[model samples]
Target: MSDTQPATSQTAAVRFEDFGLSADILRALADQGYIHPTPIQAEAIPIVLQGRDVMGAAQTGTGKTAGFSLPIIQRLLAHASTSASPARHPVRALILTPTRELADQVADNVKAYSRHTPLRSAVVFGGVDMAPQTVALRAGVEILIATPGRLLDHVQQKTLNLSQTQILVLDEADRMLDMGFLPDLQRIINLLPKQRQNLMFSATFSPDIKKLAGSFLQNPVTIEVARSNATADNVTQVLYKVEEEAKKDAVTHIIRERGLKQVIVFSNTKIGASRLSRHLEKEGIKASAIHGDKTQAERMTALEAFKQGTIEVLVATDVAARGLDIAELPCVINYDLPYNAEDYVHRIGRTGRAGASGDAISLFTDKESRQLADIEKLIKHNISRLQLSGFVPARSMDRRPRYEESEERGVQAGRGSQYGRGAYGSRKEKVDPWFLKPYEPSAPTTKADDNGGAPQSSSKPQKAKVAALLGGVPKR
Candidate 1:
């Protein structure tokens, strides 16, 4: 059944109390200051409560997590036990995310929603010691949130079992495919019981996602709270054309011009994210970077700092683009346009959350015209191209040395460097004086034998060179 009817204001008027959820769940919702369900939540909660499979699609910041989580908790409460034994709290609901950050965020939401109830929830992902997670798993939890790789790792270690998992949620299924987690997903899905209810939620739906749902879900109800591949209506999007070398300077200038206190600058690569973060810090802005290359603790620390207003800007890769819920983020800057058009929706979605007005500022170079066009095509509209007035480049600001140093650490020489002509910048390599010396031949000295027959060499016999084991480099 299709739940694609346009959500009117009437839906907005619907309260969470009307769902007939457990008092504990309602109490937890109240504690979080949430009363009314968002459109997606309003639609999917009831369907999920009926024990039906769900394929849910909604733009970011539409409360998709609670839409499925609240119902999953409600369904699992009937079997929830207060027993301390591990068997009493078997993992009944399992949620999988593509990245560790999203997994942890979902875990937080799940823990908050189920806190007042007897249900126990635990989250497990890589980049941390597994001892704690193993202990928690052995202690038993009714709801488990994890990434595919770590989930499989625990399974291999015999610390987790999914045969009894009665409900499955693939949050951000499209991103999982993009991150090459399809095989891991397939392996995890195979371990679960065939009769479990399935729920797949994402901001955008693609052909691969549909095929995945068809394979796993048994006639799941399709729920679309917004148009497919649509951006948030509350976000104002704009693009500025700049030279590739000037993008970092533009970012700094934008933050300064607007006096933005809380913003996330999205980069297409981890190195780019780190570099931009360093630049902002050098410009006297409190900023941090998070990406796949960062440790779980580091990423979480940066996120917590950003949320607590300790950091003004958080430069990040796509790992933080999805499932990052920051209240009234105000704005998000794109240091580099995303390679995938769908990612543009998610990147901007970091801001303008929950009906809050936000601005999405993007910096695109001439070479990224195709990426910009793709983003515009996906959103079904042209972004407002604005000129940066009264902005000065870093070179003009007499920061040419800093620019040159950053370029040296960037792309290799002879390549089309974004910052400058080459990392060396017309500098010549220094030659060592030893290499200029001419080669000379020396006559071997011989020792005369007492027999006066043939002269014996004075030098000792040289040992034959031996090859290293395992086909490694040979000894000199």
Candidate 2:
């Protein structure tokens, strides 16, 4: 559980039976060909089975679903009656995911693990038929996995109840915040019982996550399967410095030269993803864009096509890319680098899953130096630069931060620095030498005080020589 410890290896020697799981759960694991327990599962399971809250941090494809779900299902089954029908069971466990893809994946794993048990569970999310979700909720189940948005919709529609939920799991908590789900999470938590075991899981537990935990979780046991926000060790990061207008050419080159068969190209925005997908299509590559605007059906169809090699490339925005469980994906290309450094970690995480080797290539323009720098600092490694034969960038030498360019320069100006130089070159800090030079005020020396108290100046400087030396203010 310590941060310095190595990632929970998939090949850890621990066995599922070592944990106090039910026979049905062990049977299900054996059926799934999982004889060994992953580090997260081995470390967190016993604690979870003890009914204590847990904050789990692990990278994707690290068998985290089993880490919490196995214990949860086991605990629920321990309390369930053998004679009671599942249709009358209360929702004892609640797992909330940020995206529909993740909710479905978690639901599938829960079902698979509980295949032999008497427990029943259902998944609900947005962008699909709610009638089916409502029907499933109406039939009492022990577990409910849902996305924040769709779960709230169910609550508002009077089709679901969380008051009876005994266990709460926030899977992918960071992505939930990234997608603006904090408010929704609070609303859902308020609906749940006051005393319930809370389990929070994320690739990274940033300060915001800690604050969320403070409010929701009791004194919790922390488990770190991998360092927070750390990129997968199997992912090879590659950077390409290209002119802004030449990113299209660079993509085509990477695909043709490296013979990349299937790649997920990430963009910073939905519109950018759509544009890049169209451009790649015109460049003779089969491509499709996936983002929040696209319906869940469309996103799933595109993903399925990409997985089956029907589409060579899939372009997507950051939020839209969450919960994309693509295994053995050969490569991930950043058509545009993400604004958040942590996103770079998650973006490349899509590839290099389940201990498979993969590549993460990012296209960088000189104008995006700051965003690029942020990624390097986050992962704590500089990506190796790859200069293609025909795509040498024209402005690749500009090392200035993103704020030094165009509209952002004005913001830089407001800071301490002056243009491109050192801090505070303004006149207030260093008075102009011309004004500070030896020069007396040119005023009427003997004009008896106008009001009999003091001498007054009659006229201003005529030739403007003294005035120019005094910063255009006539000496009186």
- Whole-model lDDT values for every prediction: 0.87, 0.81
Q: What is candidate 1's lDDT per residue for 212-328, written digit by digit as tens?
A: 888888867888978899998889998888887789889999999999999999887777788889989999999999877778899889999999999999998886556788988
Model 1, stretches more than 4 Å misplaced? 1-10, 396-476
lDDT of 2 at 93: 92
lDDT of 1: 0.87
The Cα RMSD of model 1 versus the native structure comes to 10.4
Please identify model 2 stretches exceeding 4 Å from their true place.
1-11, 80-87, 390-476
Q: Which is the leading candidate under TM-score?
A: 1
lDDT of 2 by residue, 1-476 (tens): 22222323345667888876778888999899988777788888888888988888888777788889999998898666554554467788999999887888889899999999878889998999999888888877889999998988998998887778899999999888877889998899989999999999888889998888888888788889777778888889888887776787788788888888799998776656777789789989899999878999999899889889999999888777888887789899998887788888888988888789999898888878999889888878788987676655343443332222111111232224322434444433445679778978764534556578776655653453444564586557
**For every model in order, what is the number of clashing pairs?**
0, 0
Error of 2 at 219 (Å): 0.9
lDDT of 2 at 371: 96
